[model samples]
Target: MMLPTRLQGSLNNELNDGETILWLDQPIASRMARGAWPIVLFGIFWSTFCAGWMFFTINMAMKTPADQAGLFAWLFPAFGLPFCIIGLGMLTSPIWVRRLALRTVYVLTDQRAMIISRSFGKTHVRNYTPEKLNDINRSLNDDGSGDLIFEKVISSHTHTHRNTHSLGHGGHRAGGGRSSRTRTSTTTYGFKCIKQAKQVHELIDGMVLASKPVAEQD
Candidate 1:
């Protein structure tokens, strides 16, 4: 499927001359499936927890003596009402996270790269000619999902520092502390958690090499 024209227009104006192409870090379907599993598991656990709390509250309220009844019974409904509402609200985060997870995006224009990451709105962009790319590779996880990897797409000419961080602290923190350090390294674009990563890597490798001038090859 193609991005709507309005979204296409939002691409940087500098990307005008050459064709624009998009790729996902993983297939959209695979991502959706992966994302849904967590939500389902969460619902199951949440329901169990709520049921336990409800049962406990009701039981405790029954055990109170009639003379003390006014206190515990009134307290039960007040506390339960809020707890129930909050438990329902917990559903929101997973749904939103799952929706975002279903997408892994890459935009390749004549001279730069843009990557939209998983389960969140983190977008990473890089500006560099193909000649600057040092290498490209495909990476896969044990679960058989993967993403294309672009190594060293930063060079002196295409480099700019306008956009600093993509997929900030929370997005990458789950995989560990890899993204925490502050540094002055050049930014590169890669497919993150997409299916068929190797295939995308090869396609990019070919495109980068083909874009090179004969003099550069020599």
Candidate 2:
């Protein structure tokens, strides 16, 4: 298939001399942003804390007598300035992600699958070659549009540990049971929320299978 008109210039530089583009399309921006609320909520919580800290600190500084106020009073309030800015960035990230979805393109070629993204004023091309097509998963929706996951990157998570201790004859010799919970996050790379996801998945599977050595297929 031919590359979209808008994407041609951005992608031509990245394509191989003889590479065949089998499919090309942009993700549904709304779908790309479906997972945004969690992050926004977390951002709100984070910013609230930071903002609260700064407010209270500054209020205290203002109440202090001019001659009695020390350098630490004003300095401590400034510490939260950067953190609050970071929190605000997070709070607005979902909107930014949605906008980026408009600029993002997903392509599948005989040689590879690619996600061409424009982020922070730079173009990023993420490729998954036929050799790396060991695992391909899909999530379908009733509307006949869904996601085809080619890559999953789990960035690491915050883990909370809780321990329950029972005192035996001696506290030093007591046995303890541990319980832990974690808030894990994963970044999925795919042709997200596109039409005919099943067909695209099957087509890519076929292409990958055809690329494999006969012995490997057997």
Candidate 3:
């Protein structure tokens, strides 16, 4: 299938001289959004509960006298602010995921596969060679839509930050505490939420097997 004009324009510069496009498509946005339902449901409950708790704290603070309220009144409501913000973000996860899908395009070529994404005023193109596509995994849905998994990349992320403390009695002493967190995430690359996934997966699988050296194939 021909790609959208915008996608074609973005992809033209990356193609080899004679590369042939076997399949091209954008993921189904609505289909992708379906996966976020669990997050949305949890977010709804979380946001409701946090908002209610924050409001209750405010009510209590208002009813209490200033002398009794002290710093607890101010601290109580502020503590819930971040959770409320986080809950709001989760509530809109589906909408954000769907928007992300709309800006993504997937392509299968005679020699490689590509996942193109447009975000933050930039076009990013990812290409997977036959070597990386050797072990293709596929899952098809009842409606003829599915995902082709070509690469499983395990990445490690690290975040480092420092903590500061205050000293007593007009003497200032400074000490630094460092904290680091390491996380591993497996990122799957492929054509996701596309129609006729079985056929597409088979086509790519055959090409992958054929691309191997004669010794390996035998």
Candidate 4:
């Protein structure tokens, strides 16, 4: 879908039509943003149940024929601990997944595409405008992991650099030194465990690079 006109430059200057707002997959958003706590709670409960069951089973086994078997008894507890730990960890995977989902935020605007990460407030806001956009590149690994890395189109001016740094890092050193680091004008966007991520990356990268004038094309 075409993005909103507000995001495009110059009211008179025609720009490629893309959707104004492309929200991340709603299923992803629902689980991460709205249903995270409940899911986490469910996971905790389930994990606890399995852990308890495993512990009980181990004790019972030790008390049963295994213990009477003598030499094999010590091996039971030794083997049980690792299995318990692994099961417990498996149960907690949802929490980690939830946190990852929570950290993800995606927005596309007229002037830029913004990603506001999950923190108390906007922790990471990446803006990709035409000027700062150096190059839009997409790469996919054999396993289907893909990324769209927006290269900084142009170096940040003194005032823009200073202002961005101030807001981004509380005025501390950011992006290495302002002089040495050419600030990225884009965000790192990827889909975890999602199929066809490379196609999506390529589409966005094409739109980004297409914005340049013919003479500017490399």
Clashes of each: 3, 0, 0, 13
Model 2: per-residue lDDT, tens digit, 1-218?
A: 45445566678888989999888888888877877778889999999999899999999999999998989889989999899888988888878878888778888888999999876768888889887776878889998899888788877665666566667775664656666666768888778889889988888888899788999886
Off by over 4 Å in 3: 1-6, 67-76, 154-185, 209-218
How would you encode candidate 3's per-residue C-alpha lDDT over 118-183 as one tens digit per residue?
777778988899888868888989988999887788999999988776675677765668889999
Per-residue CA lDDT of candidate 4, range 1-218, in tens? Answer: 23223322221132247635433321153333343455546657766766676677667666787537575555555555665566555556566656655455444334455544444432444556755544545556576644445553444533333323333456555443333334435434433333345665554555566777888779
**Model 3 lDDT on a 0 to 1 scale:** 0.86
TM-score of each: 0.48, 0.78, 0.75, 0.34
User: Candidate 3 clashing pairs?
Assistant: none
Ranking by lDDT: 3, 2, 1, 4
Model 1 whole-model lDDT (C-alpha atoms): 0.55
What global local distance difference test value does model 2 have? Answer: 0.83
User: Top lDDT: which candidate number?
Assistant: 3
RMSD of 1: 13.7
- What C-alpha lDDT, on a 0 to 100 scale, does residue 121 get in candidate 1? 38
What value does the lDDT take at residue 128 in candidate 2? 91
